[model samples]
Target: MRFSNYFIPTIKEVPNDAIVKSHILMIRAGMIRQLTAGVYSYLPLGFRVFNKIINIVREEMNSIGGVEFQLPGLSPNELWMESGRYEIYGDDIFKLKNREMVLAPTHEEIFTTIAKANLNSYKSLPQIWYQIHTKFRNEARPRAGVLRTREFTMKDAYSFDKDWEGLDVSYEKHAHAYRNIFFRCGLKFFSVKAHSGAMGGKDSEEFMVEAEAGEDSVLLTEDRTYASNIEVAVSYREPVGRKNSNLSFEKFSTPNIKSIDELADFLKITDKSRLAKSRVFVNVKTNEDGTKTNEYILALVCGDDEVNESKLTVLFGLGLRPAHNEELPEITGADAGSIGPIGIKNPNVKIIADQTLKEADELVSGANENDFHIRNIDLTRDVNNIEYYDIRTAKDGETIPGTDKKLREAKAIEIGHIFKLGLHFSQKLGAYFLDKDGKENPIVMGSYGIGVQRLAASYIEQNNDENGIIWEGEISPFHIHLICVNPKIESTKIFSDKLYDELGKKGYEILYDDREDIRPGFKFKDADLIGLPVQVIVGEKNLNEGKIEFKLRRTGERFLIPENELIVLLNNYKYLFGFK
Candidate 1:
């Protein structure tokens, strides 16, 4: 590829809107151009990298017996409705043409529909079907370049099996493939247990790479044996310890002290273990008849802890959103931040408490009245219509369950996810297969996905410097960045052109900077900005020395190799550029 002809169009100044390092570097390197928020056009250089990553993923998937399929990006609403995800996805789904179709955010339903039609026997079990295609989601906030985009490419695979054991084996194969795919892409990532979210699966694991601009929070233990996404992370919180002090059913005249901190300060009480924080939410469920019903929920957690809404949604197996402030007054007869479950006026409301507050006694909470609070309330005694579950968000420094070491938290980008889907989609979509015993059973399934574009951006996140991207050798768009430092000089141009041709003949992918219109300084900056694994600088001074300046993009290591020895050194050095 000749730089003069290629459409890189590298920029000297960064875009003002570029926030993350990857975004800035990608723009400056002329790899991607933003068309609209969360949508981008991959230039020639960027698309080359994208294709390389896609090929790597395809090879790994193929190695694991994956059969590639190109599923449609737009799917009918009936497919989602049959799988019972039309409403669960809610506003995140991009509905098209009077809600008759949807841009697919995932292919589980579509794949399952295919399986139902063709895979009708136990002998067809253990089938791995995959596709590398576009996916769409109506993201509320799309940021961090391609890290969180509304439209992007994804490598999604679904496995069909006859039983749970078969599903486990299939899941392991995908896990193994994912490890290799990311490893080859030059990404440093760790896999952790994760919540399946809208995917509706179990035994889910996410491949995460730590980055400051990451959207997901991951919890890890000291020994690294336990790791999880914050939505489903668990920690050993200390049991609430409190003393009743002989105060029973006492109503205090707290004026305008609604929040736990405000109430604690007004009462001159520092310990928040005795304070109960109340939150109201509404769970919307759509019935088979297409009618929707809203269920009011009263959730209580220790004042020191905040409710994790994801965990609540998973536990209750429904779609939930926080109740509006105005809706609270009508349900609990109280204003915002002061609604409690004890002696609640709404009899139809379902009340649930965090497990941390189960044995807790003499807790202070809202009195369901204006400017009032109740004391000496026991959850086991006073709360009604209540259930107990772990709904509090896990925090840093919390002890790990069954271990003394505390949990540490970090932000990370989720590159890939594998799920033991079991029979969620199969059962809903009637994707069944006949077993050896002649019994019809829902096909056990597993889902695996890697965001190909996000993986490329994650590599940038993990392997970049101030200059530009440092691509891993195996995934670089071009292996060598051959720069003619003095293109105007005939000798330099002739030597650089000869070397580029020789390198190409020797099975190397080279990007030759043969543009006579650009100066040496601009060429050097562009080379650094593009971040090829290795750079070969052919300058007049080096030509006189019978040597070429070789620089490594990653370590900034430079060496002067004799022109005749270039091939041998480059052949040996490419192995050292990317993942070991």
Candidate 2:
């Protein structure tokens, strides 16, 4: 591809709105143009890199027995309703104006629907269906270019299996494929145990690359052995409560002490272990008759610990959320600031406490009255209908469970996720298969996804310098960037033209910069900015010496290769640079 013929409108200055390295460099390299706030148009150069990554993903998935499909991106609302994710996704999903259709952010529902239509029995026990397609999400704050876009490309796959064991095997296959894809795409990433979120899966793992602009927080041990997404991460269990078999409590007036910090300060308590923070939640269940039943719950955690809503939601249900301010008065008899289970006005509200508080004694809690609190409390004696679970967010510096190593945290971009979906989608959508015994059972499932654009941006996040992006491995826009330093010079142009043709004949994907009237200095800067891993410079001075300059964009290493020997060196490129 000649630069003069191709349409890469390279910019000298970075856009003011771009913040992350990928966003800044992509624009200057003329890789993408912003069509809207969160939408973009990939130029010819960008599309080449994009398609290369897709091809790599395609090859890996195909190796894992994945069957490719081109499903419609717009799905009917009935599919979402049947899966019970229509309300859970809320405003994050893109829906049509009439609310009858949706632009799928993920393909689990549609794939399950398709599985229900085709697969018959255990004969189709395990099948991986995949597609490389665009997805839509209504991101409230889309930033860092394609890293967080409303419209982007994704490689989504779903596996149908007969049972849990089959699902596990299918899940591992996707995991293996994901590892290969990331490695070939030049992305440095680690997998973390993650919550399935709205996907409603049993266990999920996220492949993430560390970056400053990342929206997800991941915790890792010193050896990087144990990793988890902060939402469901449990580094270690905190010891908080004293063993109190039976204890008593007394109500006390504590005016304007709403928050745990404020209450700790009011009581002059520095440790905060003796103080308990309470939160009220309501899960509204929609019945078959179109009526709703509201179930209220009271959650308790140690004063210093923070509540992880994801953990809570996973424990309860998707409808579980912090109760509204107005509804709190009706459910708990008091507002959020002073609501607890002890002597609570509501009898039906279930009390769920953090595991650390099960044996806790002499703990302080709310009085269930305005401007008042209860002290010297024991949960075993004072609270009824109580259960213990891990509902608190993991804090940094906490020791990993069963290991002395403390957890370290970093922000990372999530590139891929694979889920052990079990029977969540199949059961809900009535996708069942019959076994040899002739018993119809819900098909176990596994869902895997790789965000194509996110992978591109994440590669840039890890492999870039002040000059520009380092297009390495299979994701490079071009294998070689051949520059004609003096296009106006007759001898230089002739030599460069000949070399360009030779490079093409040698099976090198070369981008020839043969634009006349462009200064040598500008061409050099543009070459650096474009950042194709290998650069071949043909100049008048080098032509006279029977030599040409070869530069590596990544290492900035330059070599003076004899003009005739250059093609011989190019033949050894695959072993040296690992380019396609």
Global CA lDDT computed for model 2:
0.87
Please give each candidate's TM-score: 0.95, 0.94
Candidate 2, position 308, lDDT: 88
Determine the backbone clash count of candidate 2: 0
RMSD, candidate 2, Å: 2.3
On residues 415-486, what C-alpha lDDT tens digit does candidate 2 reach at each position? Answer: 999988788888899999889999999998888889998898898889888888887777888889999987
- Give the TM-score (vs. native) of candidate 1: 0.95
Give candidate 2 regions above 4 Å deviation: 98-100, 243-248, 287-290, 571-577
| Structure candidate 2, residue pairs in collision | none
Using TM-score as the measure, the top candidate is 1
What lDDT does the true structure give each of the candidates?
0.87, 0.87
Model 1, range 1-580, lDDT digits (tens) per residue?
Answer: 8988888988989799998988888888888999999999989988999999999999999999999999998889988888878977888999997758999999999999899999999997789999998999999999988888899999999999999999889999999999999888878789898887765677999999989989899998867777789999988887785454545677778889879999899879898877899998888888999798988888888989999998988976656889998888788888865677776667898989888887577888988887888888877667665798999999988977887877889999999999998888999999999999999999999999999889888889888888888875678999899999988899899999999999999788899999987888989888989999899999998899898999988899999989998888887886844534
